[model samples]
Target: MPLKHRFRTDAALGLVQVSPPLIYALVMLAAPLGTIVLFSFWTQDFLTIDRSFTLNNYREAVTDPLYSELLFRSLRIAGAVTAATVLLAFPIAYFVSFQVRPARKSLWLFLITIPFWTSYLIRVFLWRVILAYDGPVNGTLISLGIIDEPLSWILYNANAVVITLAHAFAPFAILPIFVSLEKIDRSLLEAARDLGESRTATFFRVTLPLAMPGVLAAILIVFIPTIGDYVTPRLVGGSGGTMIANMIQTQFMRLNNAPMGATLAVIAMLSVTLISLVLVLATRRWTRSR
Candidate 1:
């Protein structure tokens, strides 16, 4: 049967629009994921990957304390980034959406995304330079007499990782929030005002509730990718700042343990997915309660 005869015009149009991306995803994403699943169950020796199946990789991944620490560290750092990104982005998003004249909103939003125009690696290194012992931060502090000497604690640690990731993901967090805020109905604020609510109260009561979806989107966008970021941690995250992705990279490249790496990848993916599901459910509950 012809597609048009089998489905209505709108349905056919929807399918047509979706099919290209779906096929591309299947080829690019699904195929690699399926391969990783297979590799996760197999064993690898010093040089050769064993075709035989085994549960040892999964066992080792769970039983090892180092993996857990790195996983937890990644989660904690990613969570901090998510919170910081959302908090910082919200004000800018709110200003652009509600306060800025419509004519210049696009320009302001374009400025938000200007960071992405630079190479990501360059940005990471730029942070390193800014936070280095004798760098601008220390130089400024010394000039202002805030400190007598350069601080050695700024660049190479978890704090640095969180700061860099939060900065890197800020635009992502902001755009979604801006989109959400822009979608809020103007009449909702009018309704709140007519009820004798103050400006702050109206925002808290009406605007926030309506903007939760965008906030949630911003959180997920920042949280999910930052947790697995290898480059940021590798560059600025000294000994104590390594995340789960760093270990996975070690397993795959340094140790020549593809199976273990694949297993770790799977575990990290599942863990992130589980946390995201819980967060989504909790947000839904909270919104419903409100």
Candidate 2:
């Protein structure tokens, strides 16, 4: 074959290989998202979609006190969970990446992931037992003379929801942070140390900035899912812990408002997407500057 013909053939084959993934993305992801976007704007009559575009849903979602309250609550709780996860996961990831041998690091990673093999519902329910008024936590506290009576505030509240979600998401934070920490060149830390930097200064100047990408990724992973979580809130949130997701559920199943439910979902999705984008841009800028 002539050189020009060979180049054309290779380009054609490349296009053919790429087409499958593009088609799959359109069908699996784009199609469902398109439907959600349409449904967000469509009006509904007693659970039936009327196929009429209206701003009524958005108006209600943004203006109504009930939904607005739920949205703010969800945002606050998700924010707290994100902050807690980052603070807690960073040290574990640092230790695993920098301190442990490679073989033992793999073992620790395996241990972190192994718990996920069990049913998530079961694991969450287990927390209920542990956090209950008459549970081991209270029992141990009483035995240790920390409290005379069982703490009623320990279960079925916002605190419970945050704790449960944080535990669930800790591994997500750890893995990304660990990967980023591991990828950092050891020479960077050594150079900082050789410059007469103390351990704390070296960590702040050399380690933390390099690990920010992983921290950003972990925040995105935890915050997005925790914001949309229905099971944890319903299981342990009680009245105070009711998130926007619970409101969406009520709209769909009990109130028979599919359009409104979908609208809330879309709004939540857009919020998460915006946050993720901001983090990505910030991380890119930080990486480039560093």
Candidate 3:
């Protein structure tokens, strides 16, 4: 066969391999995104939608102080949850990666993943029960005489939202960090220690740098999804805990303003994309520098 013909055949084969995933994305992901973008520029009222193009939705979604405030608040909450999840997951991941007996590692990992077997809504409600006035947390504290009354602060608040979300996202943070930690070459740590480095120094200089990619992955996975989590905020977040997703929900459902809701969704999605890009770039540079 001529060289050009061979190259064309290979290219066609590559396209064939990619076509299924490309078509799946086009149908499932791209279609919904396109619809949202279209709706965002339109108008809606009383179960009626005007497909006519306009920037009014974007104008209100952006210029409205309420939308901006909620967007920032959502970012903050998502940031906090990301930090907490990564910090808490790191040690457990480290323990599993470096300390667990090889035979027991699977068991430990499986146990950690057990929470995923339950429905997400069920887990949220379980947190509600645990944090309720008469729940185990307050009851235990009161029985131990640690507090005079059931603490009202634990349930239906921003802190509750954070705690619940962090717990819910713990496994996501763990699995990635564990994969990263597990991939580190053990010989590198040994080499660092041979140069008279303390265990702590070796870990900081060798292990942590190698594991940073996983840490970044964990951050993006947890932060992005949690930022747009309407259910958690609605269930656990009282007025003080309402995130941008809750606002979007109110706009779409309660207000029957689909255009504004789609606009808000687009804004939220763009914010997450921007933040994730920054994180990836920053972490990539940091990893290379190390």
Candidate 4:
């Protein structure tokens, strides 16, 4: 074949290979997203969906005190969940990566994923039971003389949501950090020690920096989904623990305001995108500076 013809043939073959997924993405993801965007600009009146474009939905989503409160509450809960999950996950990942025998590392990872064997709803319900007023946690605390009675604050509140979400997303945080830690070269730590750096200093200067990619990945994974979670919040979070997702759900299902629901969905998506971008840039700058 002529050189140009051969190049064209290879390009055509590549396009053919990529076409299926491209079409699938457009049909599945893009189509629904486009519909949501279109719906967000319209207005809904109980049973009627006005197709006319309007900013009233966006205006209400932004200006309404209820919406603002729920949005902020969701952000706070997601932040708490992300912080708790990542902090708890790092040490476990570090131990598994460094302390566990190579032959047993797979076993540790397998154990970490055992939670996935059960339905997510089941786990959330189990947490609900464990955190109930008469549940094991309060029972143990009372028996140990830690409290006088069952704690009402732990269940059907933000605390319960945080605890459940952190536990649920623990594996998501651990795996990425483990992958990052595994990629780190042991020689760098040895060199740092040879130069008289203390254990803590070496970890801060060398280990943490290298593992940052995985940490950042874990952060995005846990933070994004937790913010949009309605089920756990609804099950464990009373009115006090209700997040934006619950509001979105109520708008669509109970209130029959599809436009308002879409509006809230768009706002939540944009906020998540902005926060994720900021995190990525900040991590990149910090890594480069180090």
Candidate 5:
């Protein structure tokens, strides 16, 4: 074949290979998102949906105090969950990456992923039972004389949502941090120590900075999904724990307002995207400076 013809043939083959995923993405992701965006511009009145393009849904979503409150609450809860999960996950990832024997690392990772064996709904329910007023946590605290009675604050509140979400997302945080830790060159730590840096100093200057990409990854992983979680809030989070997602569900299912629901969904997605971009850029700048 002529060189130009061969190049064209290869380009056509590449397009053919890419076409399936492109079509799949359009069908599975883009189409639904476009529909939601379209719906968000329309209006819904009880059982009727107005197809006219209007900013009424966005106006309500933005101007409504209830939506704002729920959105802020969701952000708070997601932030709390991300912080708790990442803080707790780092030590475990460090231990697994640095302390464990190479042969045992896989076993430890397997153990870490044991939570995946159970259904997510089951795990959420388990947390519900574990945190319930009369459940094992309260019972154990009572037996230990830590409290006079079952603690009502632990469950059916924002605390319960945080605890459950943190636990649920722990593995997600741990895995990324572990991968980052594993990629770290041990010689760098040795060199830091040789330069008279203490264990804490070495970690702060060398380890933590290098591991930040994974930490950022874990933060995004936990924060983005937790903000939109409705099941945990519905089951364990009482009125106080309800987030924007629960409100979205209520709008769609109970209130018969799909446009409002779509609006909330889009707003939540935009908020998450904005926050994620900020986090990524901030981390990148910090890492570059380091």
Candidate 6:
């Protein structure tokens, strides 16, 4: 074959190799997102889309107190969950990465991930059972004489939502932190110790700083998903724990208001996107500064 023809043939083969994934990305992700963006702007009648561009839905979502309250509540719950998960996961991750024997660490990691093998809905409902009046938690509390009556308050509240989400996302928080901690050079810690730093000081000055990347990753993983999650909050959060995603579901399903639902979704999406971007930038700066 001529050199020019050979180059063209190789180029064609390369394009063929890349074509499937490129097409799949366009179809699966870009196409749906494009449609959603279109839907956010387009108004719909009860059963039909009018297709005219209007900002009425956006206006209603922004101006409505109910929507704003739900949005804020979602943020608060997700933030609490994220914080709790990170706090609880950090020490566990530190131990697993730094202290554990390599042979035993894999088993520990597997145990941590066991819950994830079950269905998410199943896990949420399991919490409902665990926290119910006759459930294990209330029973234990009552047996311990902590309270005369079973606390119904514990079963369906924002606190429950936070706790459940934190539990659910704990492994996510742990894995990232473990990865980050594992990446740290042991020589650095030895250097800190040789310099006469105490254990606490060594952790703060050496280990924690190095682990910040994983901490930030865990935050992003937990915060972003938990903020948008409607499932756990809906199951356990009764009235006060209702989040923005639940509201979105009601709009689309119960109310049959697609435009309004899309508007809320887009708003929430924007909020999450902006917050995530800020966090990622801050984390990058923290990493760079160290």
Top model by TM-score, which number? 4
5 or 6, greater by TM-score: 5
TM-score (C-alpha) between model 3 and the true structure? 0.95
lDDT of 2: 0.90
Shift of residue 232 alpha carbon in model 4, Å: 0.3
- Tens digit per residue, CA lDDT, model 3, 11-83: 8779878999999999999999999999999899789898898998888878989899899989998999999
lDDT of 4 by residue, 30-145 (tens): 99999999999998888988999899999988999999999999999999999999999999999999999999999999999999999999999999999999999999999999
Tell me the TM-score of each prediction against the true structure.
Answer: 0.95, 0.93, 0.95, 0.97, 0.95, 0.92
Instruction: Evaluate residue 256 in candidate 5 and report its C-alpha lDDT on the 0 to 100 scale.
Output: 94
| 111-140: candidate 2 lDDT, tens digit per residue | 989869988898789989999999999999
- For model 3, give the 10-residue run with minimal summed lDDT: 3-12
lDDT head-to-head 2 vs 3, winner: 3
Per-model lDDT:
0.92, 0.90, 0.93, 0.96, 0.95, 0.90
TM-score of 1: 0.95
Instruction: Give the per-residue lDDT of model 5 (tens digit) for 60-112.
Output: 88898999999999999999999999999999999999999999999999999
Candidate 5 global lDDT: 0.95
lDDT of model 2, residue 110: 95
TM-score, cand. 5:
0.95
Candidate 4: segments with Cα more than 4 A from true spot = 1-9
Using lDDT as the measure, the top candidate is 4
Model 6 clash pairs are none
